[model samples]
Target chain A: AAGVIQSPRHLIKEKRETATLKCYPIPRHDTVYWYQQGPGQDPQFLISFYEKMQSDKGSIPDRFSAQQFSDYHSELNMSSLELGDSALYFCASSLFGAGGPYMYQETQYFGPGTRLLVL
Target chain B: EDQVTQSPEALRLQEGESSSLNCSYTVSGLRGLFWYRQDPGKGPEFLFTLYSAGEEKEKERLKATLTKKESFLHITAPKPEDSATYLCAVADTGRRALTFGSGTRLQVQP
Candidate 1:
């Protein structure tokens, strides 16, 4: 079974630097979601996209921006990183039953996550 | 604002000990309630999804039950491998994104 895949399983950066994270959603899955989980904290919703369009946004910081491409892959860009930005960034994918006779509720499947550290 | 609260931030049990973790949530027009298991340094693994009050779902040694106000994750005869942080989240009609509760860390000792 195919699952969501995220690039750069680990990342290290310094303050005032920029970083980019990529997500490849599961095949046939139409929705992509991003989350940030700090150490000892629960995963916080960051942003989401459906069909290459921004669908929703959450607690994402002002220095962070994200977009989905026509290929259905998504990228999150962060600039002027802070130490607090160090956390596990997770990308999840789900199917919306788009263009199908079956109507399915949103159910998410998460990737392994990218661990980012700001030094 | 929507809120999800988990109780007893941490728990420890001997192998085969049965216990339950509680997740209480307050949201408008609940679309779905989900349970996930997260290891120390990995992303969450999806467990169960309950759509309405009185709904119940189970997998292996875990069972999840939902009501109008809360949800309970009951682990039966758990093994050490079952130890992990259990997280609960809710998707409301207002947003496609989920609001998560601080997870309950469960440790099963052999």
Candidate 2:
């Protein structure tokens, strides 16, 4: 089965530079989520989108932004990058039912993840 | 805010040794509890989802149980291939995204 796909499996960046990571969700999945896992740390939720609309926000930094397109693919864009932003950035997809009224209550399928190393 | 805490940060077991991992959580609305296996440098692989208290689910040598305040992942028997980080997470009615625990790294020696 085709799983969630993420671009640039590994990324290297200098301070203050900008980066964009893309995700292709499984066919027919309606919701996308982003998470960051620091070395030896737990994964933290960044944000999510449902039906191409921003659905929820977490501890993401102001310099970071993300969007989901009509095709159900999503992107995570980071600007003025700091070294602290270096981590494993991962995306997960699930059937629509995340928020109000439409909670499908399904498990999320995750991508292989993009490792970011900020210098 | 919803949170999850897993115990014994790390565990080591010999092949055929059975054990269990603990996951304690606090959430406003317990939508679902999840278990995932993560290999190094890869994303988490979905394992199980337990929705209600006293619920139990099993696959292969692994079993998951949920209660009002926590969950447990039981590994029966042992194998080197079973070694990996087992993560616990919960989806709350408050949000669509899941709040994950720090995870327990397990190493099975053959």
Please tell me which predicted candidate would have the highest DockQ against the true structure: 2
Q: Give the TM-score of each candidate.
A: 0.96, 0.96
What does the lDDT read for residue A38 in candidate 2?
Answer: 96
Give the TM-score of chain B in candidate 2. 0.98
Worst 10 residues of 1 chain A by lDDT: A97-106
Off by over 4 Å in 1: A97-105
Question: Which lDDT tens digits does candidate 1 get at residues A28-109?
Answer: 8889999999988889999999888999999999999999998899999999999999999999999885313232247789
Instruction: Give the poorly placed runs of model 2, Cα more than 4 Å off.
Output: A98-104
Give candidate 2's error at residue B10 in angstroms.
0.5
* Candidate 2, A52-115: lDDT as tens digits: 9999999999999999998989999999999999999999999865423444267899999999
RMSD of each: 2.0, 1.7
Write down the lDDT that model 2 would get: 0.93
TM-score of 2: 0.96
Give model 1's docking category.
medium
Q: What are the candidates' individual DockQ scores?
A: 0.63, 0.75
